[model samples]
Target: MFRRKTTEEVPAQTEPRPERPGSKGRPTPTRKEAEAAARERAKLAQDPKAMRKKQREMRVESSRQVRQALKSGDEKYLPARDQGPVRRFIRDFVDSRLGFTELLAPMLLLIIILGTGVLGENMRLFSSTLWIVTIILVILDIGWLRFRVRREVRARFPEESLKGVVWYAVMRAVNMRFLRLPKPQRKIGEALPERYR
Candidate 1:
């Protein structure tokens, strides 16, 4: 501590003061380079084939994320529904054709069954009814999974919208039920860069 000659006391200054740089300027990327980069991003977002490829990549990454979450004892993953073409059709089918999604359908089905029992000639119709129920449930299951994976991607990335419409369509195709099972195709681990894995 040091006593100021004119005032009171001033604390001892021991730390070295940091020096500020005198001249600093923003970096300037070449115009040609900037244009090239922009084009590359647009291609990634708009190219149908590239978009499909990214969707396949996303599927694999999603599976790995699930496996890792399970291994680490975290209950964080949940699914979200996108209003895209596939989801729209699936939701519509579930809503209109299958009574399994809305309570009204099940209730109506119950009513139909009771009415059929009373009517007495349409009991054979129950067989077809049961088959329809099974199909609806299967579709619902696939829709549910697709929604979940899409949700995980949204939560993990910064982009609210996907690259573009074409890419989105491609991704939707790649994430089809037939392609997305945990079979022995290329995996997230295999697809990722070595450093990321």
Candidate 2:
């Protein structure tokens, strides 16, 4: 009765602990492997020429992708101006219609030839008249295109901004079909899809 009882102490664990969820599930890397990896990293860091060359190659590839995208009308690689469904719809709409502005380039060339007296002095008056007529037609065509594009854009994209859309459509309409960037997804008079994206 005079002797006090002692509490038993638990033994320290010797077995390996269970892996936690999301653990790597492998043994830690050895010192040699770690040293090798560090050395490789240092080697890459020290080689400025190789790094620069790699960067240049990447940029060239990126440029190539952008050019291809512009030609093919792929949305992922298109430039800022050509991106978005609204711009695409505008491009298709402009491309599908034959506008008088497309004739302006060839007419201007003819005017230049006539002005140079290569076609004879009598052609000069004709050239001036043609110039005036072409200008008037272009103005009328642009005005009509702006109105139609604005109306369609409003109907299709109710909440979208109309800021530069009319101008963008006009510019696209001004270019000859073959010369247009993102190259005319819709053919002349082809019905456009309900959605552009």
Candidate 3:
């Protein structure tokens, strides 16, 4: 029955640990140092000249990459007109043939010169007729190219859209072989492999 009640004393609030000098741990930066770093960061971010220079450098690098991609026939970097296996097949198909479309530019120049009376009046009629014939021939050749490309694309890649592909092929055909991008993987008159058909 003689149980005694013990009283406990509470500890007072402790002070923060003092920072050790010359320790191997990272030293806390002073306020001025932090402000200086912040100012440097802000200067870099806000400088218009620097931003513009960076953008220009990026654009040049991008242009270089795109040009290389086009030269190498890299599908990832190709434009929408040249993308896809179907378009590649169409390019190969058109490139492999000796298309009349290849003469289009020269024929146009001939027509222009002839129509301008570079040839005498007596030959004017001949020039006019020649122009009409050339136009007809170009149309016919384009139609034939479209037809052949369509038939082959249908046989090879039925799911792809024919929208831009025909125009792409026509454009490629009209361009001189040496100037065409992704330069002519096959020689003129080379037959497409049977598998592509």
Q: Name the best candidate (by TM-score).
A: 2
Candidate 2 C-alpha lDDT tens digits along 75-184: 77899999999999999999889999888899899988887877788898888888899999999999999999999999889889999998899888878898999888
TM-score of 3: 0.70
TM-scores for all candidates? 0.23, 0.77, 0.70
TM-score of 1: 0.23
Candidate 1 CA-lDDT value:
0.46
lDDT of 3 by residue, 84-106 (tens): 67777887898899877888888
Clashing residue pairs, candidate 1?
A: none
Runs with alpha carbons beyond 4 Å of true place in candidate 2: 1-44
Better of 2 and 3 by lDDT: 2
Query: Model 3 Cα displacement at 156 (Å)?
Result: 0.6
What local distance difference test score does each model get?
0.46, 0.89, 0.81
Ranking by lDDT: 2, 3, 1
lDDT of 1 by residue, 1-197 (tens): 59656665788999965644442333557999899978877998888899789889989999887666434422343233333333332222222221222343444566566555665657547645765665677467546645643554454433545334323322333343233222122322233212210
- TM-score ranking, best first: 2, 3, 1
| Residue 64 CA displacement from its true place in model 3, Å | 0.8
In order of listing, the candidates' clash counts read 0, 0, 0
